[model samples]
Target: MDVWPSLREAAARVDDLVAALPAPGARSAAQRAELGTARDAARTLRVRYLDAHAEMLYERLTAGTQGLRLEELVEAAGAGYPSVVPTAAQLESDRGRRQADKEGHEIDQGIFLSAVLRSPSAGPHLLDTMLRPTPRALELLPEFTRTGVLRTRSVLLERRDGAAYLTLCRDDCLNAEDEAQVDDMETAVDLALLDPRVEVGVVRGGEMSHPRYRGRRVFSAGINLKCLEAGDITLTGFLLRRELGYIHKLVRGVLTDRPGSWHSRTVEKPWIAAVDTFAIGGGAQLLLVFDHVLAAADAYVSLPAAREGIVPGAANFRLGRHTGPRISRQVILHGRRIHAAEPDARLVLDEVVEPGAMDAAIAAAVERLRSPAVVANRRMLNTAEESQDEFRRYMSEFALQQALRLYGEDVIAKAGRFAGRSG
Candidate 1:
């Protein structure tokens, strides 16, 4: 569909300005300065263009969700870090990136997501699509129910008698999230919710292979810093996808377009999080949505967003509900670590167990929350606590906040340093 004439003009201008700017590399000192100036000019033009043309841009883009889902279209429009460069190709030399250039483009797409998520007409449809069970999950669900286990790149889904366990399986990185893990994790989540026999859901960490913690289960270390250093993580793909995808599904559940599904309620399951050694950053954010949490005595959790110079997913809005405002501030901004056994951490960790007994404790906790009322109560709880409107508002703002941080000079410099140390 053709867009408004003004919007088309603005978009054309945007393209011309972007085409004039140099690509990511700037070799000489003079070239670096020139690159910075050109990029700044592009940003100025884009933001002003957005201010003048956001609505038409949104309408023009969303008009095609019939062909591409809103999520898919944003990705098609360059919403994240550049696609993964092959390992051998990357070994040659430094990328020398001062900031995430893709983010300048992602800013516009991010705003579209934020806008769609909050629009009364678009929001509901976006929610349905965003929370829809992934294509992979749909493909694997039938086999999953019969076999009782479903595995993905970053998650292990095991269906016991009544509970479906969604275990993070990125053990090589201590269950840290990376670019590929989002879909894997979300697909596993979809199966758990759709499985006819699953009464409740449980998420825990798989055993780690790191020499220091070999064979020991370690709940997530959050976003993979190694991947970040490698420039693999992106604003839309890794960051916003988690918020709108699996994490949201953990609380809001999945919806589908099957016959009668519109009248049928969302297929939500009450979830239990079993924190083993620790839940850091993204891991800690997961805790906020679970109906119950079981943590080992030695387990700790933290959201080191301030230290990492990025937003901590939904923690800024949701952690306060668990830890209260003061402690939430400490956790998000002051880099405070809250061990499972601590008093301040009590609210987030429902029950603490001995490290070796996490499995048994999780089973018991699942049984306790396994009644048919669990999902119903979860919906009720969400209504009173973190309503849809509230979540929508936070995410809408977060979409842009996170994109800014992903491209911040400090964050880029930090990633380069981390890469330097590792290399």
Candidate 2:
């Protein structure tokens, strides 16, 4: 079927609706109506594209790429399609039923997630990607082999005594992550996880060098709302980059020991989080995956995503494991703030140390966790706790819900009000 023409027409309708809106932050009933219309058109466009591409991907996966090279497959699929064609090496590496399973699983995830975002179906697709044994090729890939220091503006990576310290350093905004910072953090985590010199990894927020912060450390204030308010980052962009690209990568790395790809080997190292001050929104969400959490006495954690009208990445899936279903619902649905001093905070935080002694506490914890026995135990625990199928299911739902809420007129209006208050 010739779907491109319909896609183009839908795009044009969306463009027309957008062009009718007033300037950013200038809210009006007319502008709200225009945005709602644009959102509807965008969703329709997304559904059309996803449906067509889903069929194409399924065919490609099932038909075995017809022995075509990766670039050739891309050419065959034609332009304006999804750009997730597997590499020649990836295709060649698959052998027999394993090949079908690998390719089919990847394609299924891609299409299932696409459909979820385009529509609202929470049911899981039947795929054995999670239940199957790890592929031999993936197992053979080097786990941790970094040869040199990794540098980044937003994160500081230091290796000492078989542990790598990854400190979030954007204290000027209390380590609030913008797109670049998110990219930097992801890179830092990857480097630390892959470095053979590192056996365990620790993530913490750095003490602010800015005068206003008075040398205090902050875990994170969450996504850079200022950038969002300035229209520098669209809600879709933030969801894709910060949520899917950044935090999701970290969560996958921690839980499955694998990076965000199916082809990568799992890193065997355990990760620890040291939270100081407050971990708000995405910050608290990040802590949910850590094997151990050490928080300062003054620190408090919150998932204010409900208030902000966004989904906290992976928190819904993993937070329940730590905080139980009821409290997880309360923290997420009711926007409850959890202070380190609260008994419920113990569900998430392993320890709460004196505010000024977090460094010493983390140091001791790190030293104690350096034993081979501890590593083995941690790995066993991780194997028991992590579920790839569950993670994939939660993420699909999150992507859909987050997109709807983030782009909805009500949420945009709420964000604008927040921007006004902050300004």
Candidate 3:
């Protein structure tokens, strides 16, 4: 039996069910039951569709059509039936399947790398790949270095005592990221890693310049909700630029030592996050990837993406590694706030110091950690903690779920509410 036709029929049924369901207010028992039934059926159909889609992609990959673009293939796969054939639900399902496939590919590549490293002849080729930028990374360099938008620098790179400090300087929005800031940040990270003079790296938020947060420091407020509310950033752009581009790049850069490749690297410089005031949403997510975190006593952290109706980038993968699964779930699902003084905060933060003493504490930490032995130990610890296979799997899952949440209806509604408030 042809599965594509059946998948299309299932998708149509899901669309019909969604149309029949009661509108967004409180629902009666019968309405709730009907909605639940529809959701269950849709979920099952979505899984089947995803599996078939994966099979089709595999066929294409094995049939000497590796030149075909992934997005184009996905689009071609869904080119049948009505406008609602590839609904939000189906798209999300497809994303998950694609992510899994990507993880598998990366794992195979990593196995190849390991084999090459072990070989007497191919080890130099692996190092060359690490030292140079791949074609895809080169394509993204324009986004990283293009300047002319904002007068002030969003990311400031400073060198002190053999350490490179990349400060988030967008105090106007409490260090909330815009496109320029994201680009600058990616550039700063790249420069820091490539600079041989830099032995260690520190990332911190600057003192707020806005009236609302005057004289105070903030790590970041995550994505600039004002931009989202203003429709300056569409759902597609948010997924591609912010989630996949900026946040993903920063996390991968810190965790993986290499300049290129999505797979985690065996050698990476240790990174420290010196968070002050508040680390909300994307800011808080950044802390998860850092090797160590030092927060001011008054600083508080939260993954407010739940409130914003979106997924916090990479937080789903790394939060549980810092905090336990329970706390991570609460923070992600319930918008739980963790203050520096709280015991649970210790999971993510290595130390909590007096508000005015954060800089000194960070300096001391950097002084102690900026050594060749420390770098080697860090790489060893990272390898022991999680393999490249595990990292690839987590990132793949994160990319899919984050993309779906960014483009989902709930986030759109939340953005509308934010726009209303700003207006």
TM-score against truth, every candidate: 0.85, 0.71, 0.65
Q: What local distance difference test score does each model get?
A: 0.73, 0.61, 0.60
Clashing pairs in 2: 144-194
| Candidate 3 lDDT over residue span 1-423, tens digit each | 445565456546655755565543345678757755654454455445443454343344335432222233233434432321242344543343312111111211222222333333333322223233223335544543343111237877776767778888987778877666765765566556545567778999988878878888789988787665543443333433444344443344432334664544522467889998889988898887677899999999999877898667668877888788999999999999999999988998999999878879999989888877877677667667655555545544544455455445577677667645521
Give the Cα error of residue 131 in candidate 3, in Å: 11
lDDT of 1 by residue, 1-423 (tens): 223344445555445543565654424557557555654554454445544444444455557454345446564433321221112122112233334433244555565566656565555556556777777789998899899998777888888887888888887778878868887888888888888799888888989888777898888988877677566676666887788888889888887666766644688888898888889989999999888888999989998888788899999989998878899988898999998788877878888889888778877888788787777777988879987777877887887788777767788777666545421
Instruction: Give the Å error, residue 358, model 2.
Output: 1.7
Q: Which stretches of candidate 3 lie over 4 Å from their true place?
A: 1-153, 230-267, 419-423
Residue 146 Cα positional deviation in candidate 2, in Å, after optimal superposition:
8.3
Q: Which candidate is the best by TM-score?
A: 1
Candidate 2 residue lDDT tens string, 1-423: 656676666655654554565543465777767765654564565556666565455344336422322223233443324223323343333323211122221331233344533332222221212211123213322432433444568887777778888889996788887767865765666566555577778899999876666588888988676655444443333454455443544444422444464743445567789998899988998898777899998899999877777677678878998988999999999999999998999999999999878889888888877777865676566558865455555655665566455445555555666655531
Runs of candidate 1 with Cα error greater than 4 angstroms are 1-22, 27-70, 75-103, 258-264, 419-423
